[model samples]
Target: MSNSLRLVIGEGLEHLEAHRAGAFAGDPEAIHQARVALRRLRSALKLFRRHLNPSARDGFNDALRALGRTLGAARDWDVFVLETVPAVMAVIPDQAEALGALVAPAQHERELGHVAVRALLEAPQTDAMLQDLGSWSGDRVAFSPRKAARQLIADEAGPLLDRLAKSVSKRATGLEEQDDEERHGLRKALKSLRYGIEMLESLHGRGNTKPYRQALSVLQEDLGRLNDAIAAVELVHRLPDQPGRLVIEAWANERRQEALIELPAAWHQFKAIPAFW
Candidate 1:
């Protein structure tokens, strides 16, 4: 468990460094990846809370989540400009100028988001949080015994994966026509499950996890695309009235419907796939 925890926390910090480099370079994917690693780290912490100080576990996870949100806002805009906008333009070329206008605001938002992330990273609280996490991962802080650490996979990790899967399957029973909130919940659950598996990847050989992770990624991407459409519509709603807003909404709606149509099959496939943990 200590090794697993160390692996997750170490990689998470490494990702934050990558995010810092990317932020300086203004690379969108770096910000996105860092946020993702933060999320995975938090999920890993939650799964192993029994081995950690209860107070420390929640506090560290909360701090990382707040950081993730900062990067997430920037990533959201990146998705809008790089993905949603392009998709919209392809379907509604006449709205190019309007879409360009949308990009301007999104770019501004992403810039502000980067500034926010940088500020958070520079804050004393953020430094303390990372330092504490480093202590745990680096063996300066002890959370569990050597025996416990080694047996975490066979004793604890597998069961957590099974329980999370069951929960998601129950939540997704009527997913296709489900409201926005339900699909959103499904996405969150799936990510938790994915991260849980990822944290244990070192325990399981890649031969088992590789295909499972790839398959899991397909559903994650589909859910992400669906959520992007939903979010794009919401973002457009917040903008000032313009000729392009309606067209963008129309395209988003079409995309949203298409995603909804595809999601159930993906969900079914996900359910059919065996757990690798």
Candidate 2:
């Protein structure tokens, strides 16, 4: 196996171990880090599929995706309750009455999220999935030719780009509906796209994919800010009435609106860029 593949597999297993040990300790940052490792492993496999069995890689990818989604929900809820709510309160001090209305519902949502995360962790499939990954890592794999690698990358890049386009479209739809959860899902999609782009850059030079990279970066930043704002709003809604809540809420609202306006333009720029694939 190539050094990149070996590194990714090792890193993935390490994180999986931590996850299995409940290292997150119900902490959002820990959960996010574990999810990120899973993502990196998935992206690595996608980028280097030419060096492995397609069927085996696909199965591993599917498992990682499932785990990532579960962890993502838990992390999002954690951020909303612990980080975002307070920030929102700071921005909208005058809206204390409205913010108070959100506390019970946010707490209820967080409880549900906690249950889901625990269930996912305890699922039997998780063990089997990790074993499969272990098996793959232990096996010695041969590398494909450069030509084959290029072709595989090109093939995968098309589908990846399509996935990103669909995600952006979904986010647009969610924004129109004012569905916070759906918008957060879109942020997750943007993250996947950004990570994919980073992996691709490892194969293709930065110069070759500069426009795509730049556009993707802009989208990632915009979506990241929006996610933070959304989390802030949820957080402030959960906090007891406080003097600083109004200021935070106002700031979050302003940031959210700015991010919303910038997202489409960044997305359009991303769409216009020629795919290196």
Candidate 3:
């Protein structure tokens, strides 16, 4: 079990490093993938927390979270400029010129965000942190050598996945009435559940996991549309006051209403899917 934990953590590190160059170059997909790697690593640690040394685990979690924040800042602007703005532009063709002008400020902010990403990548602490984590994953001190550490991952994955699934359902109980913060909480829970399923997919086999994964994907997409609206308002407000900003706020409100109307059906569909694990 200890060896299994090391393998999983090592694979996460490898994934994180693989996208380093692309993320450094400010590629949107790479930045997203890099952020995902950080998330998977953090999820893996929490999934197998009982088997790890608390002090070392806390240190690694803190470092990974800091890196995640840096990547996330850049990713938010990427989604704004690349996805949200273009989406609005498509619907309001008459405002294309106004929307196009808005892109410059968002892009500038994005570039500044990427500058922070680059700085973090170049910082000595980043390398040291990764190296330390990589080493710790294999170190005897990192593993508690408890009974749980000796159990097979397959035996444990099902319960771990169940907990994550329940977390999403619990947060989603009053979905329609949830405030932005609560809805945001549900989104986070959904992501964790999805990641948990992905991490354990090999254990369950693709045939068994496919239906649940698909349902999860659809539910996530619905919630994401709603989230994009909420996020769009924040991004637009950060820009100077202008007509384009007003246009975006109105567009965002429309998107939010549409998403809210569609959310219940999507949630119900997701709820009906049987647990694959």
- Candidate 2, which segments miss by more than 4 Å at Cα? 1-3, 19-24, 138-218, 227-256, 264-277
Q: Rank the candidates by lDDT, best first.
A: 3, 1, 2
Instruction: RMSD for all candidates, in order, please.
Output: 2.5, 6.2, 1.5
Top candidate when judged by TM-score against the true structure: 3
Which ranges of candidate 3 are over 4 A from the true structure?
none
TM-score for candidate 2: 0.63
Query: Which of the two candidates, 1 or 3, achieves a greater lDDT against the reference?
Result: 3
* Model 3, TM vs. native: 0.95
Candidate 3: clashing pairs of residues:
none
What is the TM-score of each predicted model, taking all chains together? 0.89, 0.63, 0.95
Q: Against the correct fold, how does model 1 do in TM-score?
A: 0.89
Which structure among the candidates has the greatest lDDT? 3
Error of 1 at 236 (Å): 1.7
Candidate 3 lDDT over 45-158, as tens digits, reads: 887777899988998999999999999989999999999889888999898888888899999999999999999988999999999988888887897868877778789887
